[model samples]
Target chain A: MTDFWLAAALCLLLTMALGLVRVMRGPSGGDRILGVQLLGTAGIAVLLLLGAAFDMPALADVALIFALLAAVSVAALTRRRLTREDS
Target chain B: MEMTLQLWSMLCVGAGLFFFAVGTLGLLRLPDLFSRLHALTKADNLGLGLVILGLLPWAGDGFQVLKLTLIWLLVLLGGATGAHLIAKRALRADGEEMLE
Candidate 1:
């Protein structure tokens, strides 16, 4: 709940928003994937910041789960894309 | 002691934010998929690490710290693996012409 954490979180949110531009304007699918990854990473950081600021330790766990799933999603997408290419 | 912790936390968090900003810039400005992947992995990993470090002092316990570290490690591992796969796929679909 401190000013410092709040400000940092806001900055991270800004980066996530900027990343969306890349997602929307991508020259390729990989680039869009990268944008989503950026957003996911930023979102994790924001969750951690909020967890700290609000003294809710449980949010950290949510962030952990989010991070794990985000990575898996990327891997799954890449695999699917690769397999699609074979056919 | 409290003031020092606050200052240190601010410095760490600010640095993390800066790295994220740089990574986003790289994503925006980088000319190709490989280079963009390079930017995303390096900057975002370091950025997330620094942010976690900044928040370490306030962590509820040793368990939380461990959890945070695990999350970071997994993200990096996954990101790297995914990047490799994407590169392989991109190269295959586009042929060698995509890189140039």
Candidate 2:
């Protein structure tokens, strides 16, 4: 069980790395935001896997909060961007 | 019976991992932000859904099952909302570009 969890975590890390490459090299703010979105989802996955791997339930609690926060941040950013564009 | 459950879990997790891989590949190779978002939101959501479902039987308690399910739901909400926001902005930009 731990082995499978660990493998899932490792694979998520790979996804995060790929997301990072996009974040660093992406041509515009859109790509950066997209990258952040990728990171958020992947981060949650890693946390869940780690929770399973270590038998720690708390990790999932954190993931729940993280998901809400990630959405809020993107909403805030999008609001600001639209406002700035209109003005 | 134990082996069967384990085997089932393993397949689910493996499939989940493959979806993540596909999501990342689409993220990297897609031509634009909207298309990438399209790939990611669909793939990752399905991926995580599989993972959580796989972990359900192994989970130690009822609370853990609830927590995992909540986490998956929250992520789906976040991904959908975020992708919508990004796509709206991208479309706006596309419109502006067309105007110019």
Question: Chain B TM-score for each model?
Answer: 0.87, 0.89
lDDT tens digits, residues B32-73, model 1? 998999898779988999999999988888999898888788
DockQ metric for all predictions:
0.54, 0.53
> What tens-digit string does per-residue lDDT give for candidate 2 at B2-100?
999989988988898889889889889999877888898889888988988888888889988998888898888888888888788767774442112
Docking class of 2: medium
Residue ranges of candidate 1 with Cα displaced over 4 Å: A80-87, B94-100
TM-score of chain A of each: 0.87, 0.87
List candidate 2 segments past 4 Å from native. A81-87, B94-100
lDDT, residue B29, model 2: 94
Model 1 residue A44 lDDT? 91
TM-score, structure 2 vs. true? 0.89
DockQ of 2: 0.53
In model 2, the clashing pairs are none
Taking chain A of model 2 alone, its TM-score versus the true chain A equals: 0.87
- Global Cα RMSD, each model: 3.2, 3.2
